[model samples]
Target: MQLIGLWALIAATLGPFQNVLGWSISGALVQGYDPISKTISDLAADDSPVKWIQSSFFLAGSVLTLIAAFSAKSLALPGRVALFLAGISGFGYTYFPTALVAPSPNWHVIFATIAFVLFSAWPLLSMRFDKRYHWSLRPLAAISATLVMGATTLWFLLTWLEPGQPIVGLSERVIAVMQVLWLSFVIWSQWLHQKKGAPETAPELAYGAKN
Candidate 1:
């Protein structure tokens, strides 16, 4: 179980790493892709020349995230559920790539919204009050992380909703990076705690067993 948890944590960390790398490389490979104005999803749009690259990355990230969700026993159940749903959302949006000339209210947009909401809110859902857990999973720290992610997500939403918003892509990237970094921090912290001889079970579980 400990080995499985370790691999799960590593997989969770790699999800974000691959996503960031995916967009960076795909964006560069496209002849006229503009990160400032175009969102990451644009790279996987039906008409995108390098759609395969971005789509492949999205699929890989989602699968890795799902692995963590099911196998990272250090995380509270609620957090794991959130990660699972987020992974599902990732697959949804990736599989339903946006069409360059499609109308609004598409599946891609719906799934993307769900993904962002889950990502922004997962920290709060996963937090534990136990001091035995990592500081990042503490109530105060989790609340702060959630607030920061929520605020950035709100900024991205505003840019997305308002037509002709020049910073839409930039704002989206900012929030995405922020959320993933927080997740990575939490997972890595838990892995470190386990390495230092902390109990393998989640804090809540350990507390329950103690009682």
Candidate 2:
């Protein structure tokens, strides 16, 4: 599961970069378009010479993410469920390739919105205030992580909602990068906690043990 999280982090971080690079190298994309508002499906549109590259990234990443979602024992049921849906949503690009000039596309936006909301909410939903779990899963840490993620997502939405927003791409990238980093941190902390094999006792019990 830790390995899966690591791979997911890598894919999420690099996939966008690779997609943008492929599009630029192909010279088929319009200059100065908002990458975030364009939707990832736009990168895989029929007109794009680099469609295969961007499509493959989302497809492969989604499959890997689906596997990780099911296999991660560290996450609670809610988190796993949220991740499962998010992973499935990643396939929207391939399944609903948006036409380059369409005023309104199909499933792409719907799926993306679902994935974004669930991903933003999962950290808080996954919190388990138990002595047996790692500190990352504790209420305080989980709430803090959720707040940071939620705030970034809100920023993205705020920019996206504004007319002629120039920095939507930047906001989107920030949200994606932060999600990857937070997932990595949580998984790494859980991995270390497992390795240490030190069971956490309740505060009262630990104080009694000291005497």
Best by TM-score: 1
lDDT of 2: 0.66
lDDT per residue (tens digit) for residues 1-211 in model 2: 1222454445445544544454344334456544655544456777765677767766765675566566556778788788788888878746776565554645665676667777787788777765556878778988888888888888877775575777776786678667756665666667666666545555656787899
Estimate the TM-score of every prediction: 0.88, 0.74
The regions of model 1 sitting more than 4 angstroms off are 1-4, 198-211
Evaluate all candidate structures by whole-model CA lDDT and list the values in order.
Answer: 0.82, 0.66
Give the per-residue lDDT digits (tens) of candidate 1, residues 26-96.
Answer: 99999887898889998999989889999999898888878888887666778889989999999999989
Per-candidate total of colliding backbone pairs: 0, 0
Candidate 2 error regions (>4 Å): 1-41, 103-105, 161-163, 199-211
Instruction: Give the TM-score comparing model 2 with the true structure, all chains together.
Output: 0.74
